[model samples]
Target: MNFRRLLAATAASVIATTGLVACSSDSADTKDTAAAAAGETITVGTTDASKKAWAAFEEEAKKAGFDIKVTNFGDYNTPNQALEAGELDTNNFQHLKFLAEYNNGNGTDLVPIVATEIVPLALFWKDHDSIDGIEGEEIAVPNDSVNLGRAINVLSQAGLLTLKEQGLITPTQLDIDEAKSKVKITPIDAAQTPAAYGEGKPAIINNSFLDRAGIDPTTSVFQDDPASEEAEPYINAFVVRAEDADNEQLHKLAQVWHTDAVQKAVAEDSKGTSVSVERTPEELQAILERLEGQLKK
Candidate 1:
């Protein structure tokens, strides 16, 4: 099935299992009580690759009077849809780019409330030690649009491929300016990039996937531009429905996430694989615009 259909099915399943309830105003006593109850049992949806990251967040949430229950999804597509359908209170497995694309394509009005991490994408090889030595070698990348485009852009930025003079937010392989590198590019499922690496081929693996494969981000050879204006929008963050952004429980949860305790936990648990970023909404919007411009070009 196509991605949209799969997402619809997933959302249907979640809504079927969890009765959808109307969201009340912030001043409603019932809403406050419901939020408190929800805090005692907030369901967070994410992928297995992000378990460690969320565990740190969960511990911090508990210290802030929340008892969080995390549920793992096998793929990247389901979490936001589940959240919008009321199956999950929030999710933290996606970057702004993916969230924006999901919102645009699926019409889901989810919004990010907190910045969490910068999981650097790494260009890796099993046999070759550097990007220059990968000539004639097979290189694997994510097949999905968002990740695939990111892999291609990273390769382009590394001088491995020349993309058409187009914006960056959603550049594809078709934009590759070829003649820049000699390596053969192959598209593989994002989840399978790690295994492909073990098979002695070069690959671009997402930071979380690298962790799942027991590969350390600190040791990768060709790292993406983590601080580039092009990468800001792609930094992962926490997302909730737009209507719930001002909910008291969510605000409290956001506060706990920004504390030094959570930041330290994220750094220690991810082993410095993921960097935490807590920005005000104004600052985040500015960063997002800058990133969007860089990506668009």
Candidate 2:
């Protein structure tokens, strides 16, 4: 696979429907202890870079008798399919909206076991230094329907435009109330948003392209609040099959990723652009259900 293309896909690509093969848990173990304490091997999947950041965490899990084997994938589509097919114990790579979209689009019920950080989405002026410097001019955003809606929300929150209250989980550019907006929204491929933003053209960029574009999150003219109510749907998460919801070893794996060490590694890997957050599994499930409803509508 071309690394660059896969990298870009990893950030914003919608996965096509694929056959999922669910795997069976080993029922043959005679150990009376909890599954995690029984020296179980938990397989996980995520983007390529996650494995490196998780290497020490994996080792730590092993010390606690839960051996975690994290596999790497290049694009956003495969991991979840693998998980559904029972190839992986769990995976961490998408926000709630993406996961919900996956379930709705494919009729799968992959569920989040824990919450993770909200990746920052921001608007940067190519020439202007701040939001005030931007006029009611043409602005570029990710054209993908899901991310486009996100860009619209970020822009709306920045007081750049007004967005119609759509019942959809993720809004498209059509949801933008153009009559109440200041700038012309230009939707393009997500890979192009960084360069467009770079030229001082008003551009809303996704976090996936940040490092590749060498754009620092702190330097943006208008950045979304990770802690804000509007951002809750976008918070990333660790997901597993619904069947594994009560699996002791899988829960332990989620705990391993939620630890300070794993968080530190995430910050380091993301260059402090993203931070880890812990949300109640119930809350995450609600968000997923709500998003799923919107998609079905």
Candidate 3:
């Protein structure tokens, strides 16, 4: 897999229609689980397969007697696209908010098998040491709808801005109460947020871009608390087609992410920014349903 090419793909890449797959029977799911347990290769897709955590996860899965094939994708949409097309059994690379946007936009019903972790969106700046007392300056945020809402929430939490609706799941720039806001928001591509910050203005940089840009995660002025209830929508998870939601072996593979080895590697890879979270499959489905419903409205 060309890691650079995948990373180079913008978050705004076009969403192709993910043709629906028919639901399978419970007995079929049981048989599939049995096959996986008997050493059938489970093809899992992810964007960050090059991360250290993946190597650890593969080792752990081997110990648990599951043959895991981790296929790496370059962009956010392709893995879910592959999963929906039955080309991949499962994929772990996006949060519920992102998944909701994908499903609602493309009319696909991919579901989360288990919760994974949350990496908080953060405010970074080159010239400012604090988020306060800086007024009328343009702060760059990711323009991708899912993350733009998150970035706005981060600024709101820091008292840098106010939202017209207090609990918007996917707020936009028009939702901001600009008259009362301390800083002006400039929407830009997420991958370009770091560059915007380097230009001496505050930018809401996603954790995924911090390392490559040589920005330390610890240097963030303010970040959302991943453990909070408000952060639930952003919890990342291992997603499979809705029909495969109950596949036991796949759920077990998702749980392998929380093992000590995987967690340690994740911490090191994310520089302690990735907060491990656990939510039952039912809870994840409930969250996705709620988000999807709200999105449709």
TM-score of each: 0.74, 0.84, 0.86
Per-residue lDDT tens digits for candidate 3, residues 14-53, read 2224322233364445454455545367889999899999
Q: List the residue pairs that clash in candidate 2.
A: 21-85, 22-85, 23-86, 126-200, 127-200
Against the unseen true structure, what C-alpha lDDT does each candidate score? 0.69, 0.73, 0.81
Expressed as tens digits, the lDDT of each residue in 1-297 for candidate 1 is 221222233231222212122332433445556456532477777785354446667778887777667888988889987888788877878888877667666856677777777877778887555776666676799998877887887876777767777456666777776666556579989999999999988889886687679886666668767777667767777777765554556657766766776677677666776666667655664555455445445
- Judging by lDDT, tell me the better candidate of 2 and 3: 3
> Per-residue CA lDDT of candidate 2, range 33-110, in tens?
334344345677888545346776786677667756778898899998998877777898889989988998898989
Ranking by lDDT: 3, 2, 1
Over 4 Å off, model 3: 1-33, 127-129
What candidate 1 gets wrong by more than 4 Å, as runs, is 1-41, 127-138, 180-184, 208-214, 283-297
Candidate 2: stretches off by over 4 Å: 1-34, 37-39, 50-52, 127-129, 166-168
Ordered by TM-score, highest first, the candidates read 3, 2, 1
